[model samples]
Target: MNLLDHIASVAALAGRPWHDHAALAADEHLRFEWYRDAVPRDEIAFLRLVLADPDREMAISAVLARIDERARSSIDFHSWADRVEPVCAPVEFLSRRLAEWRLLIDAFAGRPVEDAAVLAASDWAQRKLAAVVDGDLLVLLAEHGRTRRVRALTRVPRPARPVRLSDRAVTSGPIRPCYG
Candidate 1:
């Protein structure tokens, strides 16, 4: 599937809505123009609702659980990353990180976690991702959880991929002809 469809599928899984083409493009300049052009306006509005709210981490997780359920009832997450460019990394990262944050918040708020439970959670949260899109998302999420206070959760930065030369588009440049 194409990127938008992939994102929609994942969002469908995560139960989070995405932004409309105009709104998404408004927020992020690089959305595929042709794809954006084709999406319906109401869908875009629904997408806007998903993108607009930052307080919906729990809701997003619920959506992801649904997506996971669908996958389990059928197939594995094949091409999971490519299917949801940018969105997958962010959602995956956010979901794991939010869960980690919940633990930390519990700890700080004096809620107790069994030592084994904390270790297991940390291990799961800090595992390195293998896919290109999911690369290090889990680790970063864990790190984010470790570094911040619960009250500062809203201020956490979104996941970012490292710049790779291979991912760049090539453009022509002026060149002089070589002498024979």
Candidate 2:
């Protein structure tokens, strides 16, 4: 099944109607409580639900808030990883990461900018671009000529060091399995 289908299935399992925006909004309090207390698997599932829906910004903000809370409480990486893995698998994480990178690039693409006033402006832009496109999937896109337009706008020079693909990029296949 595709990601949408997986989302629907997970929402169904959670007794939520994935497509009913008004219903979701009306039940925001309950959703918030669920997010607050959910285990890692459920939390990731809920996050994917929000990310897939149009009300993504609010949902993502809530998730980030919870993450911040957990971090401040001294939740360590091992604990977080134990909760997040297998459900929020590396491939799934990588796909979302790449999507966010593309979104950021697209958001900046249309804005007009003056010529760099100093070397720092160019350097900052290059650094930001490098961070967004750091992983192998993005580098593969660059290699396949998909990034030429973005590179033109960002003027991000390729990294001087060899790019090591993240373990997250080594997926068994697409984030969503194709049933047919």
Candidate 3:
């Protein structure tokens, strides 16, 4: 499965509507099981190295180093890096770092990255999944029954468009204001 699919599956297994801490913790173990069963052993080992590193920058640098090494050796670096990136960040900050690294890789390779909207949406989803996996967000959600609204509030707003008035001849002396 692709990275997004794997993320969705884990999120679904964690909870519906919202995640609870207990459920998230359980899902974390289940996620490992799924990764073991589905992903190749070598990839899993690489993932472990990435996730085990406490320093987010170091973890990202390590992944980039591997990508460079693989590229030099004529290996399928992009395919492998794609899978490893999501797993490297089990936390929100690290996930942003991962996204930044991804963009940097794309720029360095002269490959066009996805549009800003698409990238933002993907990053948001990844952050939510990471928060669920980390369990802290889930715990907070569980503690406050109505906290689901907080999630809605936290969502990134779309950019507002500038309003433009049409230049048209008016038959009346005064223009009537219309409210939607």
Candidate 4:
């Protein structure tokens, strides 16, 4: 589907009304090209609104992907970066970092983790990445990730253990975590 159609569909999913494309566009450059290209200005406001709702992030991300594909092909990205300073740096850095990390992930796939090495590497990477992507954001993400892992681990049933009496051993119930 074309960009506006995709935008409309996402907006519809969010129960948002169609908005004018002109208002939602990034700048006059994009707007002028949109007009020059005979792009319709009606019914595409969800681009702005959906950004405010976390639930629509995936859909918006898809739309942004399409927009990115189009923008890279049609617009002067460096010019846009000049207007929106620091725009390209994070994306460029993260893209490079993600590529680097993907190789590590692939190498580690299906392999047993070496805990001490993995922990040390993770600590170093987290510290480095925090410098690039804000320290507090990394902390919040790490905390969330740890919480999820802990919760998942807590839910798994442990094998039953034996309780010993004076002369007999009896199997006890599955051990579960006691969470405060």
Candidate 5:
């Protein structure tokens, strides 16, 4: 289905609640230890569960592949792809990498982990891992660039401050009226 469903499935398999998995983000000051604690096992096992579910597995795989391609080409990943990388593809790839991993998980109704499939997924995931992990920085840079460019292109001059007139100037009456 959607991301939340995928994460919940994985979390359930990990013996953790959906809420804990739902809240993780790189930008969050969360530690990797927190993730390790939540999953409480090798990363791959978590992935097999997601892939085992037919609902969003292919979609997640496609997203991961796309992200990997982007990375190989040195393109920046967007926020959505970044999310998929850690929770979806990376774990899924690991699951597939271990030969018996498929059997173990699938026996529990987990998806069968194919070596080729997982390896391919892993290759792409690893290749793009840097980009996925650093996607926030790229987003920040892009936002910063837009801000700077907008400021430069449409800058308005600041209003000049006015000088206060001396009290004498205000007090001095026009010498005036020569009896005119």
Candidate 6:
């Protein structure tokens, strides 16, 4: 899917030149496609997932790690997608995309490959995702309601374990369902 390709593209940037603070206006290093499409969809879908199964944290983190592995792999996206398409039935692909977004954000924040902070970031990310879904109303306020936004962000619990993103996690390992 386009989201996967975008993740691969952004993940590849881990090896590219870094830009100055003045150069990044929105604090987002990802492509415009991510902002236009994936971000909201990701939040909504993930919120729905959390609402459905709040206890699936371990499984979600594991799947997200696998996704980060895939995005960071050297293999072509379509080729890998084709191979795993069969194994990833129903909602597997969707979850994989969400995982990609999360890891991509982390990598840009200097948490690439493997970072201990990411271990703790997972919890925060989860809480943040849940808050956005639960507090969608606050988002309608002017300027996205700065006070409300901070409240939402501050309330998010930090991650217990950061999702792992290895250099060759996918290409060197057995391909399997990256369900989140």
Which regions of candidate 4 are displaced past 4 Å?
Answer: 1-47, 81-180
Clashes of each: 9, 0, 0, 2, 0, 7
Q: Please write out the lDDT profile of model 4 over residues 1-41, one tens digit for every residue.
A: 44555445544555444456535333434433332233323
Q: Clashes in model 6: which pairs?
A: 118-162, 119-161, 119-162, 120-159, 123-159, 124-158, 124-159
User: Which residue pairs in model 3 clash with each other?
Assistant: none
In angstroms, the error of model 4 at 126 is 20
lDDT of 2 by residue, 1-180 (tens): 543454455456466543553444456555555445544446666655544434445555555555545544542533554454444343453334333333334324542222221112233333354344545423433443224454453345545776567734677756786799
List runs of model 5 lying over 4 Å from the truth: 25-35, 38-45, 50-180
Q: Which digits, one per residue and each the tens of the lDDT, describe model 5 over residues 1-180?
A: 655575566666666673554564221223223333443354345544534544344534533443344333432333324334455544655324332222222322333333333233333232222122223322332333234443232232434567666533665566566675
Highest lDDT scorer: 2
Output the worst ten-in-a-row residue range by lDDT, candidate 4: 34-43
User: Per-residue lDDT of 1-180 in model 3, one digit per residue for the tens?
Assistant: 443443444444333324343443445443343332332336545455444434445445554444445444543545655676567556565455445545444544556544442234343333443233223333332343243543443343534465555545546577778898
The lDDT per prediction is 0.40, 0.45, 0.44, 0.38, 0.39, 0.39
- State model 5's lDDT: 0.39
Q: Considering only N, C-alpha and C atoms within 3 Å, which residue pairs clash in candidate 4?
A: 19-44, 19-45
Q: Deviation in angstroms for 44 in model 3?
A: 2.3
Off by over 4 Å in 3: 1-41, 53-75, 108-110, 114-180
Ranking, TM-score, top scorer first:
2, 3, 1, 6, 5, 4
Indicate the residue-level lDDT of 110 in model 2: 40
If ranked by lDDT, best first, what sequence of candidates would result? 2, 3, 1, 5, 6, 4
Q: Which scores higher on TM-score, 1 or 2?
A: 2
RMSD each, Å: 19.6, 20.1, 19.3, 15.2, 19.9, 23.2
